[model samples]
Target: MTDARHIEAQIYERLNKVIDPELGRSITDLGMIAAINAVGATSQGDGDVPSYDVTVHVELTVEGCPLSQTITNQINGAIVSYPDAKLTPHIEVSSMSHDKLADLVAGLKAERKQNPFNKPGVKTRIFAIASGKGGVGKSSVSANLAATFAALGYDTAAIDADIYGFSLPKLFGVHTQPTNLNGMLMPVTAWGVKLISIGMFAGADRAILWRGPRLQRSLEQFLSDVWWGDPDVLLLDLAPGTGDMAISVAQALPNAELVVVTTPQPSASDVAVRSGLVALQVPMKVRGVVENMSWYEHKGERLEIFGAGGGRRVSDQLTETLGYDVPLLAQLPLDPDLREVGESGRPAVLNEDGALRSDVLGRTFRELAEGLLRSE
Candidate 1:
């Protein structure tokens, strides 16, 4: 028969492999596994194998959390999969007390150390999508790019740094506000991307929300106050401007790369180049340029409704001025479906199931996402 001590130890080992779905950490390590008790069900040694009734006490971070069932199922599987013994699993679920939850959040924040991404030797690839002019589809590109990154198996997070004119929440179809854990906020996950935006705080009456001087303070709050974990890619949808927000991004995230978005018209491309020139003033790198609304495919013909060569012109200008190759990354087609689907609360690159679509639009975004990472 398996001894009580042995059974308890084995249960812990299995539980260690069962990660908390939301936090992406081991339940045992997170202090979620409150207790484990095992007692023989039948006679101690009826035969070669022993059957035991195992009860596991799980304390969740929040009550009625969406992922609680997923955590419990994995715990049950861990107990039932023991090879040397036959185990009947009984799982108990409960939320942590007010004081305990606060402590956990405090410890996590302390360990994370204010701003995790800006810390030295951080592995996150930060991309700030900026444009000199609005109505150039910068936010759409950011949303689609973030979704593409997530679909490509990279942990992705997006911040709508355009506080006054936020659009990530709408384009990504996120209507829920972040979960307030103690003082830290949990970013709402949508389209497989963890996202936080000022739009999410539309109905909030908190005074902490941005009022007038939103350039630096707002960006700082998004970086420090939100729990982003360690995402592989972090995309920021900056407000359409030439200076203030871009300078703020450079000051806050020194390691951030700038991705300029523009259209095929000269009017947009002129400002787009000036926007990328902010990298000259700051210590940011001009990663590349994305040309949205380049063409519309209809009836087996490519129509350049928005004129042409704006993306290439911006790329060439940035490369010549910066003395480095600022390649034109991809030319995204002008599809009404992109707007329609996005208004429905989903990125155009992803399907209703949140998986990457198999169509041309998806392929273009996938290539763009891969190219950005490869060049990094």
Candidate 2:
């Protein structure tokens, strides 16, 4: 009937607004809506409007998709809320046919052929958080900074470039493996940031599954195989004692800027200079340095726990050696909440509502993020 056809068409149009949380695309656009059938089930009485029952057939990309229920629920809401007449929704779901999935993946791959960040006119601002050694709170800075960027309304993505010592998964509290669509992988989004880490990969042979001969391939694989979709900012939490990883990041993301993290002591600050000096070997720019644990506040006095001026020393050394100004960006406090709440799967810079904390440490990271976005 014309009424049925018109209602079905209207339902399809409504579905365009329902996006798949994992893909960040509409189910209708992804060919997930196999069919939509609508019919007048009954009328209330004489002079009363009729009620229609709409049946939606959905074909998902993967079987047993964790978000399948979410999509169906959205579909139900979209149809049931139609104001012209009363309506009920029935959603039937199934996995996509092998041929359909293959075609979809191939089309997507063809559309996105190589590393999206290296595009000629890419707008993504990439920052590789590096350190001379471990335990300098480099990953902590990376996690909080990415969260801050997202809180500031940027579509942010982060790669745990520290393959061997991957911790972003734990820091961000991501438990589910990435949704693999054919050969392409979807990054797990948490705290409003898209994230990818080897630690989040599943399967028994997960350790060696995504790597090749050189460890650099892991970084490249994260760039090529993941569906990033052109984020406004991309943060890479690089491994400590960096040489290969820094070089790899430069080669992979040509526009990436390096942000070095160091503590307020001689031993950590000395090697921190070497980490920033990596800009000499590659074409990457050395963004300013962040000094972590500069001081601890107890009672009414400030205590320089690790000694002061370490961040400034690294900045001065890098500026002199690299012939560019590498300023001291921020002096982060030695706050215990950074580790305690961070271990609980959320960045310390953010509150429970995912808003940037208005405290000292949070304000410092917000300024760091804003400064990174400014032109030199």
Candidate 3:
């Protein structure tokens, strides 16, 4: 016969294993376990072999939370781990309303203000991938860089801030929208990277024609609404040029490092330098320049079809204007295989080894990722 103390200890041990899947924290720590009662068996059961009814009261963070069912299952499973336990475990799930959620947000804001970046002691590195023009492979680079970071075992999230031009979804092949839990949006994982994009909310045929203020509001919603859960790195894929979205991102993530992308042509570099200048206007620091479509290999020769010296010119201009050293991070050559893989909804960084179309581009991405880590 199990003693009362033994049963209580068993209950505590089991409950310790019950983790809130969304928050990735034990229920006990989150204050979700309101009560734990071990009811004695009735007269219908034998007294020698006691039947225990464990009741756990759970408090959810948000009303209409989709993860409530999952939490209930976990709680029930935790209570049934005892071998001699015969009674069914009762689980109750309740939620806090909108007012409580607002209070929670206010508390978080206070905490953030106390320790910006919420690192408390550690630093949170933010990277912003920007370009002067669209279709310049900026999204692809952002996705692959994020994938590489995750592959190297870093907690990373890639945010598609390009509300109108969201291509990260198709590149990563993430089809499902994030599940909402306790008023928090959980990011979907792909290629080991957590991702959120406006594409998940807006359909393909629907046009995103919002002006500046509306765009800023949406961006803020994306940042605060989603539960990023303290990632080590947050990569932002900004829309091309110095638009409203870009300004909003600069203002919101003031500590973000700038990585400008451009082609090898002088005209492309000229525009790229202008974009870097715009970032400077926000008083944001420019990290370096990345030259995409630097060249293409045909047969045995390197063909500079887009013209050369664009990356160098942009880097030089940034260094001169910022009065700081701005190096050329990487020169990503043209790779048809990369384009095909991206079109097929598979980023080259996650593809099988040696299966990548352009080994040069792959190496460049890996090197860039290494540089990021080294800088940190």
Candidate 4:
């Protein structure tokens, strides 16, 4: 018979593979595994198999969390899948005491330092999605592109840096507020992406930010006060305008590249080119332009409802003005389903399963995501 201590050690090893779906870290690593006890073992009818009752104590960051069932189920699976023994798991779940949780957050913050992204040689590729004006689907593009990047197997995080006009929480259908550990906040994971936005907070919670210096301080706090872990890609959905927010992003995230969005009209394209010109003022690089609502398809015929050539126009202007190859990255279709699904709180590029769809819209976003990453 396998010794109880050996079986207990094996159970801990199995638990190490069980990750907290929210934080994307192993339960053991997070100190969530409070205790494990292996009780009396019994032999099965087969004579060769051993069965044991295992009790696992889990301390969640928040009590009665929405994902508690998922974590429990995974833990149960880990115990039952033991090769040498048939284990019965009893998982006792509880929230960390306030003082203990505070200590945990403090240690994490001290280890992370401040604003982990600003540290030297960080691997995250930061993209600031900006538009010259509103109604050009900038937030939608940011949501879908961030979803696409996450679906494509990249560790992704998106900040709805739009502040006064935040929309990522709505688009991603995130209804739960972030769990506050002491004063630090955790970004809610939705549609396979880690997301944060002003919309997720109540008015009383948001009022805490009112004391800061407007946009710059707000973005700085989002970077420093949140536990983003180490994402492979970070996309900021900036407000539709020029100068201030762009310059703020440059000052805060020195490595962020700007991706301007515009519609297919001379009016929007004119302002779109000016948005890219902010790169010349700040040290930020103009990644490229994404022309949203470029065309509508009707009965197999491509109709330029918004007028054509705006994307090309902006691309040509930026290349000439910026002295670099500022290409037109994508021209997204005027799909009604895109808006419909988005209003339903999911990115239109993803299916009901949160996986990237194989349809035309999905392919277009995938290509755009690939092109943007390749440019880096």
Return the top candidate by lDDT. Answer: 2
- lDDT for model 4, on a 0 to 1 scale? 0.88
CA RMSD, predictions in order: 2.3, 2.6, 5.2, 2.2
Q: On a 0 to 100 scale, what is the lDDT of residue 353 in model 2?
A: 97
Which parts of model 2 have CA positions greater than 4 angstroms off?
A: 41-48, 202-213
lDDT of 2 by residue, 1-376 (tens): 2367888888899999999887778899999999998876574566676678889999999999888898999999999988677788999999999999989888877888878888888899999999999999999999999999999999999999887788999899999888888888989999999999888876422454334247688887899889888789999999897657778898888799999999999999999998988888888999889999999999968899899999999999999999989999999999999999999999999999999999998899999999999945
lDDT for 11 in candidate 4 is: 90
Using TM-score as the measure, which candidate wins?
4
RMSD of 2: 2.6
Clashes of each: 0, 0, 0, 0
List TM-score per model, in order. 0.94, 0.92, 0.76, 0.95
Clash pairs (backbone) in predicted model 1: none
- Alpha-carbon lDDT of model 3: 0.77
Ranking by TM-score: 4, 1, 2, 3
Question: How do the residues 3-42 of candidate 1 rate in per-residue lDDT, one tens digit apiece?
Answer: 8779989999988899875566788888999999998756
Higher-lDDT candidate of 1 and 3: 1
Query: Between prediction 1 and prediction 2, which has the larger lDDT?
Result: 2
lDDT, each prediction: 0.88, 0.89, 0.77, 0.88
Off by over 4 Å in 3: 1-21, 31-122, 202-204, 298-301, 352-359
Instruction: Please report how far candidate 1 places residue 250 from its true position, in Å.
Output: 0.6
TM-score for candidate 4, residues paired by index: 0.95
